[model samples]
Target: MVTPVHIRPKDDEIYLDCNATTPVLPQISRAVSHTMEQVFGNPSSSHITGLQARYILDNARRLGCEVIGAERGQLVFTSGATEGIQTAVLSALTAVRKQGQVTAGKYLLYGATEHKAVPQALAHWNELLGTKAELKAIPVDRNGLLDLDFIAQHLPHALMISTMAVNNETGVRQDLATLEKVIRQHAPGVPWMVDCVQMLGKGQLQLAQTSIDYAPFSGHKLYGPKGIGFLYVREHAAFTPLIIGGGQEQGFRSGTENLPGIAAMHTLFELLLDREQQVFKPVATLGAYREQLLAALRTAFPTLELNHAFEYSVPTTLNFSVRGVPSRDIMDVFDAANIRVSSGSACSSKVTRSYVLDAMGLDDWRSQSAIRLSFGPATEQATVDAACARIEEAAQALRHSCLLLSDTNEDFDSELDGVVQLRFDAQCCYLVIDRSAREMAVIDPIPQLADRIEKLVACQHYRVKAVVTTEPQGDDSTAAMLAQLLCASGCDAERDNVGWPLAAQADCSTPVDCDVPTDGCLLVGNRRLYRVGSRQPVYLLSSPIEPTAGARVDFAFVGEQAAPQVLESVLGEHTLVCRKWDDDFAIASQLRELKGEG
Candidate 1:
């Protein structure tokens, strides 16, 4: 029996949502705060400040290098593990594209439940490559575990294989060591990549001990900073840089590094390793909590079904579905009571179910009813008891449905459509623009932002001419932030500034100036050459979908009166505009004017 920490429980704010992001460890917080103040110098700088920072950052890299069992110089500190994955994937694809084989198609072999980012990015690539690589999803059994024999059958024809060391949703260990043995015995040459984002810091990574070519782990997940993570790339394993310039990270990635986050990430790893007994005691406490949790859940909802066979699952994560009750509804109700919990995958807390659940052959009802209750080192027994009780109460509350739950009555109430239901709630902001074949610019994308805009326009009629940041100086509090997000969407982003050179056909830097005076006349062509086009009835969603899908407005429903307001707003501008609403939002739109309207 592993000894647990004597964490004196104070107040009960049981945060069982550690799967999303653990709170920054006190050690990491102190280190990052110190680095922010003392090591403000750039590691790439040559002066004393730079030299000092370089030494500090080098130490950070060395720490990461040592923790993951890589050589001192082999490990590259990335802003986060997401960047690491992007760099690795882009590198792999670039290498494949460079081989000059006309019909050479390198497929991205992935397990069914891999994180959404990996598959989504690859899906975009597959669409571009008429025959890029066929996406072969190795099947998982009824227990949400991968079928090794299934993977064994597919490797002969696959060029690359990517799997997770642990499932983020179910916490099911993938028997990676065993999986590696299978790979060594069967398919030796194919590059095997592991996404250890959910596995790192819990124990040793042993990258050198294993034969995997690349692995990704985020700093935030390891009780480090939110924005930094690292990727382990074995020496001699060639991959392309997603961001090409500045020659940073041994030419694997480019851009000014988030040294602070990286530095703290390194400290988190060091501290975690140094205090494995202290920091990871949550694992044992979680084990005990897990048994209690399962018992209570089984008692309250006797029809509870574990998402996977419990014995093979990791102690930190618990995914189970209750009969009849929607997992989202249960989560929402408990959340209202300040008891935080997540469902299916923490990545999309409101999305209800994960692609992982769907891939596991769960029906929509079964998948939607699933909730993931993960534990951390600090979780207390009483907190677990309260959280479980709250979950049951919430589940019950969700079932008490009344069509008119609100006190307000709708008489002529058709005016609520001026909102955008973001298709994906995880978005930082929404892009509201006319989708035309005209030239465009990215508003303001940081270097970290990948080819998102380009991908959005690649197959479409529209052309992205440039980018702009409404808040360029990051002063009027921010422009680079919104622009940086565009890269994540996969488009080249550039800041729009007043004396900037004109490679762009359109001015992208204009502050959306939501408060500015505007009659919506979208200028297409040039100031003197292009077309001034106006399209009426612009629809807003909480998020944007593919440009090819046309204008679809969607938002979540928050109350009884919410849906009706959506229809009214759409009717106000365009009686025929496509609209969807709920407790999600209050939507509105605008239609182009006809000759008489002026």
Candidate 2:
């Protein structure tokens, strides 16, 4: 029997990004280390050590074949799924080249939501092979299923078709049997490649029973080590080698094999395919776990909506979005609670919107705010319970507090809570909020963002305590218009304030809150603002003033006339400095880092 492993380095941390990659199980790690120590001989060497290494390699190949239900020679060891995809694309395009003359108007088809590697590989090899074939993206419905009618329409002139068994971002699985029948019926003898990276442990694939020409898999997607994977080629499929070095894998692939990674995968395969042991959870159990997690999410967020239907997606993943919260905000809250989740494919995290969701025809809000939570097949009940508890806590925190420090007015909406910086043009305004107290203060109000600010104050039921300006204001200024708007919203301001005096204008003994601006310091709620210099007045804010002492300088708002040296004097180690003329200013992530949330 395979022993269950706890792979988390910290007990408090919960990892829910298994779709991107899984933690290396302890047994797999041990297997790798043991193989490195004991089976150190090169398989190409002509000696007893080489024989032992060869035995291990062959055994690994046998296990992989058994897991995927493929024959021995059909499996080729590869670096990972990307290499496999590249190799497959090269082979198919090479075949197109060998077939007398290239057909004009021939198109290469791929699922719109396929991993970036697939389309990129197809485009790369298609140009190099001089096929001059046009590339087409097969569309998907809102549930992330392929449009079969569109596929049938494009199949006649298609050179090669590629589709994924399961999407990496949304966990939506395609109907492989139906897809195969459609391909065979419309375009007989055409090559088809399936990206199977997300399907290894979550589902079974009988490759020999289908007409799929090539399939690629990664080890890290399962519980095995990275840098090791295998590619399955149909028994009589056209083949071309991408890497040509020393003869390896019967001249199909070159370079020395990743023996340790293969050995680790051998252990994982045994756990996956062993029917008698049943090391991994069954489909039904995993589905139940998903429901339980979904319940927790529903309880916490009343407006939560799933990006893909549960009936269509793999149980290991849940892709969803909250109505008003952005993906980055939720990610930050979860991270603060020691729970890890992802926005979308780890490869495309830098890209704000999910192309997969966009291809599915989801609304802009859902696509922009989507969050993916994925767990491994071997996850236990206790871990799920702990994750649910953390999720609830994070949701509560997000609903009550403003986690971000700065954002553009274009990106910021009225639905957010807590303190926020609404930036427009070169200048910015602040909504200093204490949500629990239902109190608010507006600093440096601008007319451009007046509507959004009024909506926020009205929606959140905040009382406008004071409208303060740190600079001179003209009659046509929108600051007065903003005050009138707030008044119309039934938010009566107690004070309409003028600019604070510089250090030279006041005595050192004056109180911080005095209208005369004594000692160059002003107090608004918990925040303390200090005027730094006489010649060029720059205000430094030591923010989120708490009852505890020793509050650090978190933000600095520079004046137009402020000198660099004056600004430098007020800068702290973690200070986020901003000026009116700055092209852009964002400190949400930096503030999280200061609070140990990032």
Candidate 3:
């Protein structure tokens, strides 16, 4: 085990998003710091200080080549995999330009499940070079394996093709040897670039023995520093420098050498290739760890389904979907327990579904609810045990089914019990269901989600008991529509002379007619709603209301000008505050536990 130079802080969170990026190792940090302090010099100068820096850079390059089984001249240091991709695409298109006129009907192809960077880089450089080559995506099977038949058909007219050794989301590995054979058989001279970023430390690579023209590796993915990576170029392949400056990397790339980052990567490469020390876990050990994690997940979620088959993917990642839960809910519960996971590539935010899973033809539910859990190469057994324990507790909390629904979720028809919060744009609505009686109430319904509410009520055969509006009603169309569907009653306080209603009001045309209590408290079934006095009136729900004054407030609906101090004084700290424009929504049970509730 690598020892820390200083005392480490208490680690309260479990980080399992290593596929997105790994935390820098202590040894790597030391190496970077050492280089910055002792060997700081410009490698381009011809002085003694410069020669010392040059020695360090050259040694790092040689070690990188050895780790990947490449030769001395094959590796060129880059900022990251993205930069390497840009360089490779530029070189390939430059070679095509060197040939006669650009041919019509030519295509540039990439794997359908590739990281967004590959196809994007291909399109960017293709347009800049005026190649006009049609870009196409090679389809993948449900296992996320590239379609070889598609490649064979398009190889004759291809300018270049890009593929990944390992997928980031699914952890699926491709049959690179078979792919290489087919490419050479169809078009021998065409340039092939493989995104080998995820393959480092997880699998072996022998670049010299293969016919691959370009391959890129990133340091951050394998526990080194970010903003540092390398690209491998075949000696006989056509080459052009993407960055042109004072002669560097033999004119292939141009920049002052990042000596500190290079030194950190050198330390990482040493650890990976060190057979004697064996710092990283062996294949068998990692396989055993994966089995333990899978068992824990199955125990937590009895209906768990793997997104990709185990035999085809790397052991470090597990992409899965539970039958009834959405990914946002899962992430919320996990975050409450201090466990970090992801839905898909961190590069794409606010995307509700995984395009990778969609391209593989998975069901809409699976694609919309997939969660990715990834482990670092050096994850310890103790950490695994702690993470498994947290997963179990989080799963138990999710079983209560207090779901947070928004426009982004797809399963709007599912009948869930307890309190379900629905969000539309800036408005919030609640569905309080009494499953035993088959009755539900719609609170603060918005016009945008009117159709969804109708479909849900119809599917579940729910009798709409009442439509209650807490604020002054502007557009009563939504209330009218729900009333027409269910013939439900409406409840609201009488409008005061000051233009602000003492409580909420429904239009007279709607079937709603209810007696507002003198204390501004409305009892709907077993729930009690107290209308707090404000500029824009707010309501508090104390469920299963205790006759005692200390009964806990379960939920609160606040308006635009409901002062924070007023809420803090009136409601308990455990109350789930719902605002008009609150960006994040939390599961009711999880939020309660986080607030120190039983």
Candidate 4:
């Protein structure tokens, strides 16, 4: 008998999807709540309340720019990254037209692996708005890095080029300095916009030192409030205003600002500076955590394959796949075990496969099997340990399920009378019957064999009266799982019994809703099944002695060694029949032995 896994409930839910969105820090939450409660005045007003709001907005602008190494009065607040990207592309293209650079159709270039927002925004402005801008997406290598050679050839013909400072899906960071060098040398003053959404809060972006003309940052990705992000424009860079209304954000972006969200974002930047200093000081501590996690996963799943190299990506993020297992199945198991993870970016988790990996030259199968696990300051060692344990157990269950389905057409002969043994590698289950009584019993059936068992029982025309099982040693319990399936099929298999290794009782109860008594006597037609007591079979089907001292046994269907010497010493004279008589168990045993875990 195999025992079901028992998971301990934790005090708080474990979160590993930081790349999607982080939980707002306590300080940021407090500041946002306080501002929402106290400040509701329009920043453009002249009264004291409005002046205070104006001061808050100005302060946020100043500090936010400084954090990204931009000069004062250069940061423009927007709704979020999507709006910021649209504004940046629109402003750059409009400026190119005004500067007499669109004599031929203006061209916009971006990396092949950029977020969907960048390419789609450019397409919308190019085709729908009659901007006459042409768009080109550069290709990335197998490792998801940009192709610089193609950029060098195409840069001179483009009006603006956009690329992300860090990829959102793979956490692969691009060298902005090198890109800036390429643009300045080859394209010569072609405005560049860096989609730095994922880079914010993780590290400082020296935008002023680089040749990048524009950059975008988001608030929620930095653990601040959502619906507020900023765009950084270099001093004296060519640009046009996207919105034309009341002069807010220096006439670049119009409408009243989200004062609370802006202030909250400012506070987040300040706290982020301190957190990065503490969390990544001397060196990044996340690398050590990554090593621990990878080691644990490797120990649990020897065939785990990493999707991204460590040198090209941030340590806080990882993408990997367990060989031969579907990512959706893995995600489901993790979710059921209370571990939060993602099969792809939150934006495209529903797309079935990752376009990011597909662009990186991975085939559909590998892309479908990929899972992303990102870490944050809140992730602890204990959480990692528990999550890994759960993942390993889930993978093991899947492996067993797959193995059970293999060689389905193969048949085996049993050496026992009135018993048919179905062998799956080293494990064997028995079906017992009394032909005259027309009753049958299934012992320790696995879920993978549910259909086969049902078909066989139906073909035999034997009514399954009771289901029985022996104690399981570990997390491979098939008794409870099998009984539930059998019962659900409208078979009158109402009850199940467990034999030796009494600790299995608690470990075997989670997967089913049925009673597993420690000791019981079940009558299946004319055959009686009961636990073997000391020096005696507890009961016989047809006995006159009442079985108090000892029951005269007709025959026994021995699945495995009942106890140390219970079967051998008691039934020494009785003819012992081998429940399993096939080479399937031998093959399974050899496979396990070759793997060194037999």
Descending-TM-score candidate ranking: 2, 3, 4, 1
What is the per-residue lDDT of model 4 for residues 1-598, given as tens digits with 9 covering 90 to 100?
5455655435555678878887777777888887788877889999998998898898888788778887633889988898888888887777766766652565689888899999998888776556676788889988888899889988878878999888887888887778777778898888888999888756667787777777888887767778989888888886677787988877888898998889888786676556454432222666777777777667656667888888988777888876555576566656655668789889886787788888888765568788888876545567677766766765576445422121132222111236656654335667766666566667666554565566555444556654545443233355555454443243323332442222223322212111222233555554455444422222212222232334344444444434424433334334333333234575355435544585
The whole-model C-alpha lDDT of candidate 3 against the native structure comes to 0.77
Q: On a 0 to 1 TM-score scale, where does candidate 3 land against the true structure?
A: 0.70
- Per-residue alpha-carbon lDDT of model 2 for 1-598, expressed as tens digits? 5455844355688999999888889899999999899998888887999888888788888888889988633888899999999999999888878986565579999999999999999889878777888899999999899999999999999999999999999999999999999999999889999999999988988898889999999999988888999999998899999889998887889898888988888898889877886558999989988999999989777778999998888999999998655687667667777778899999998998899999999877788789999998989888899989987886776566644222132223435445577655345677666666666666677665575577577666677654545565654566655665563233333322243322223222222321223134544456555555433445555656554554466767655555544444556777766554444423444445545676
Off-target runs (Cα >4 Å) in candidate 3 are 1-10, 399-598
Pairs in steric clash, model 4: 1-472, 2-472, 2-477
TM-scores for every predicted model: 0.62, 0.71, 0.70, 0.64
Query: How far off is residue 492 in model 3, in Å?
Result: 26
C-alpha lDDT score of every prediction, in listed order: 0.58, 0.77, 0.77, 0.67
Write down the RMSD of all candidates, one decimal each.
20.8, 11.7, 14.0, 17.4
TM-score of candidate 4 versus the correct structure, residues matched by position? 0.64
- Candidate 3 collision pairs: 490-512
Regarding lDDT, does 3 or 4 come out ahead?
Answer: 3
CA displacement after TM-score superposition, residue 187 of candidate 2 (Å): 0.9
